[model samples]
Target: MPKYIMILLSIWLIVIDRCSGVSSPIKPFTLYKNSTELKNDTADLWWTINDAWKEITFELHIKSADWIIGLGISSAGGMKGVDIVVGWVESSSKVYLQYAVPSTNTTYHGKIYKAPTGYSIKRHAIAHKMLIDPKNVNLVHHLKLYECDPMTTLNDDQLPDGLCDEIVDEIKFCSLNFATVWAVGGDAMREFPEEAGCGIGGDYEIKYYMIQMHYDNSRLDSSTASIPSALTVPPRMEQFAIDSYCPSEVTRNIPKSGNNVIFALPHTHLQRISVWTKIIRNNAAMQYLFNSEKYDFNYQYENRLLKSIKLYPGDSCATRCIYNTKNKDKITSGCERTRDEMCLHMFTYYPRMNNFYACITVNDDSAGVLWIQLR
Candidate 1:
């Protein structure tokens, strides 16, 4: 063990021994002389003292010729010019005396002193003021004092003027007067949707939904401006065209016995236009009953086709066709059709409850198919 650890262990052992009821002998000494000398009662223990001081020492006799000892000093007037010397017979000696004068209020106030070995000693003074109520303040007098406001009830009728008056009422009157002036000048704004809601047929039922796009169209070519011409109705609708007198120009795909179909379409460009060709099929024979064009060829802007349509799901009738125009001018002009103009039908038909697939062919001939669930 290290020397310091050994010394600590010895001190701990001494404390433990005393707590366990083992008592060591204490020797008292008075320092009326300038110096005092301590004698070692055993060979293993030694002691010495220098200078004037009143103190006591303790000695413990352990094994033969071995001893443990301690020293203490006490004085009613406080010790002065005192020195305590300690050593073992064959060990090193150490001085445990301080050569310092106790500080006095006037002598050491706000001053610093150094030891003989140049170690500095510092003294500080702290001043404090006691406050009973720190937040008590008077604004008019510009002073802080311990005062508190008494608790009181509030009366709404006694409130200050303009503190709680009807500001909103004034604003409403101004708005109405401005609107009346506008109406008198024939410059009134159009009826808002909320106002129009009450007058139309006594509360009509309106449903709103969004069509979400399911495919990416970043690869479409901007320059290809021609719609395909080889638009064909699904092959299963051939017989329905004869029975229903539906013109061959329209082809409709209806389910023979189901209530819904999973329809899918490809993401097409904004310039792409499409038409809905209706095909009426004979439910009994599963044959095409009629084929007809129910609506004008509708120009399908990329935005409309890519957006999902939210029609009445189970029994809704769709008579719209989508078409794309290569010419920007034609697109802007609502897909004007010429005498010899031709367009493609970009749709896939299947039974109402079956899976439906639709594809869009880009100018680069790259096509992508999308699947959609119909209810």
Candidate 2:
């Protein structure tokens, strides 16, 4: 073989090895930042820890104007529901830590069960409400085979009469309840396993973990941020895995109400305006899981909660994603293509158990396709 050809072949093999997870470094944590010129950018710091480093401590720093920065442990990528400890700098430069858990429907089997007999009252959709009552218990009730049309102009008559608890089978996303796990803050040394029985035990193992940082360059044009983060462990402990709640659909819209963990939804391009996921309890109380008022397609991250929110059997998870359909001038449906729109919610949460799954009203169509080929 030619001298140049041999050199190229060697480089190619090295690249292949790195891509195949063969060269993944065994480290406590790794830093990741976007090299792009975009002012609003993100940095994802991953931790490839195994059973050897189960109990460890983490220390982090942000270079400048730290609007959104955090350390997270995930099963998949950063976008998937991960157990993240997020922090934001206030106007007084005080940083506060909030435990965020991504919501996924996949963790709850992502299925909708039928309403038993005597469950009639009808389901209400996510229609526009000009005048909403603060104590209104009708809008957030569980619906039986309910449909929410994004373009529909909702009037007072379209709203539900009162709380409807007809549905029997609904998936609950209560596994990612780790508010008491470990506390994190700015420039502070935080320990994972603070003491004995502090870390996650059993068959759970952390396959992938990452730390993501978001820099906001709005007021200070040239201001910068940097975080010197670290994690230390005793070298041998059982690891735990983190999973999310993502419910996808090639067809059908989200149902009205059920006891499901509906966290966040995914959209492509400029069609989406906002996405809101809420939990409607049996007493007619409302709790928001994830809310993205100004949805941006460029920065598509799961809407996470500061703490884990539980859902009972009768409670339903509701999601509403608005779009700008007026510009297209054509009827749109769900598809993978860019021109088409998708109502898929990448639900993210924790506690990877056999019963966790999504609660969409339709059956998944992508199950039959082979995993090797490209989508």
Q: For each candidate, what TM-score against the reference? A: 0.15, 0.30
- For each candidate, the alpha-carbon lDDT, in order, equals 0.22, 0.33
The candidate scoring highest on TM-score is: 2
Per-residue lDDT of 76-160 in model 2, one digit per residue for the tens? 4444445566676655678776533224210101122222223233332222112222342221111112212212232333322
Q: Per-residue lDDT of 98-167 in model 1, one digit per residue for the tens?
A: 1121121111101111112222332211211222122321101111111011121223333211101233
Residue-level error in angstroms, candidate 2, position 71 = 41
Best lDDT among the predictions, by candidate number: 2
lDDT for model 2:
0.33
TM accuracy, model 1: 0.15
**lDDT for 111 (candidate 2):** 20
The 10-residue segment of model 2 with minimum total lDDT is: 2-11
